[model samples]
Target: MRNVILYVNLTLDGHLAGPAGELDWMLFDPEMNIALSGEMRSRVDTILTGRAFHHGIEENFRAQASDPASPAELVDFATWMISTPQVVFSRSLAEVAAPHRLAGEDLAAEVAALKALPGKDMVLFGGVSIVQQFVRAGLVDEYWIKLYPTAIGAGQPLFTEQRTRLELVDSKAWASGILTLRYRPAR
Candidate 1:
């Protein structure tokens, strides 16, 4: 079975986004980009994300893949983002474009079915509510959090109401002050 990894970027204060859903505070450099791409390439084959992020960030990444002016490394990363299959969970969205499918009602069941399929692994990129659902359901197999140096005091918190104990599996510190922490649900 494939693993479901929650890969996200968080502020030092644990906010996924700013008060107004702004992600401008998250730092991204060439090294960080390369590191992220390497991890994604090695671990994930499918991406699970909320509809909001699919429409907002994912679309932008897809566009960046085809842009001639985009940096080479970013373009390569965008290619990976666009090529990977994605399942977008949304109650209101009826349809989505190619490379992405609108998931059914039962999130856990759908995730389970996906895990049963032959694949490298799946990753869930957060938009708050979806991450909360997965956390509450205890569906996530691993957590890959990239912690930024800045703090957004008033914003969407990553943990929310769910409380799950995680055992640290690995950690890496980047020169850009972004810390990558990998964890798994405590057995």
Candidate 2:
């Protein structure tokens, strides 16, 4: 079975995004970008996302991959992003283009099926609702949170009201003040 990893960036106060789903405060560290690409290359082969975030992610990466001015590491990472398979979970989207597919409406069932398939682990990039569904269903096997230094007073909280118990398995603190924390759901 494959692992379903929730890889997200959050503020010090735990907000994954602002009230309007703004991620303007996220740290854009080059070193972190390279590390993320490396990790993704080794650990995951699929990108699981919700409809709200799919287009933006695709557009950004596509541009980065084609831009000659982008750094080598970023260009490589962007290339990886566009080449990897993506599964978009949505009830409204009739279809998605190449390298992207529309997932079934039953999120848990779809995930279970995917997990049972022969492949590398899958990473979930959140758009709030989809992340909350996975969290509420207790479907996520691991959490990779890149905690930013800033604290946003008001925004969409990552944990919401759930009292989830997680065991810290690994962590790394960067000089840039960003902390990468890895956790597993306490069994």
Candidate 3:
């Protein structure tokens, strides 16, 4: 079965997006970006995201990703996101782009069906609200957190106030001083 992995960058203080949704503290070194992009390309067959982060990721490709490597990787990531099957969770908009909405109904069952198919891993980006829904539903399989060296008191948190415990499967420290912590929801 395809696994659901969250490849996100967070501060040492554990915030995904800072107050006002600022992500300036995110680590974006070319080396690590390429490495993570390669890894993500190899793993994800589909991406599910919240609309909020989708715009930011899209904007990066337009303005900040000027470097050849960065833009190239961004192109690949964008292409993958656009071309590959995508299911977006939105409560407001009607429809936007490819693959259409995977909103409503039993998302966990839908995710499981996608996983059961022969493919790479299924990934969820942005949309922490939806992510929390999945996490609370006991659907998430793995969490790959790239902990950057920074601290923010207020911002978007990773996990919501869940009643269950999650098991830490593994973790590794990168040369950039970022820690990649791997977590699996306890069964």
lDDT of 3 at 108: 72
Worst 10 residues of 3 by lDDT: 58-67
Best by lDDT: 2
Clashing pairs in 2: none
lDDT of 3 by residue, 72-120 (tens): 6676665555566666767776776655454555677677777788988
Candidate rank order under TM-score: 2, 1, 3
Backbone clash tally (model 3): 0
Name every residue pair that clashes in candidate 3: none
Please name the candidate that would achieve the greatest TM-score relative to the true structure.
2
Error of 1 at 33 (Å): 2.0
The C-alpha local distance difference test score for the whole of candidate 1 amounts to 0.86
Off by over 4 Å in 2: none
Model 3 TM-score, 2 decimals: 0.81
For model 2, residues 44-145, the per-residue Cα lDDT tens digits are 999999987887788998999999998888888888887888999988999999888999888889999999999999999878888988988898999999
Question: Which wins on TM-score, candidate 2 or candidate 3?
Answer: 2
Which scores higher on TM-score, 1 or 2? 2
lDDT of 1 by residue, 52-120 (tens): 888766669878988999998889878887778889999989898887798889987898889889979
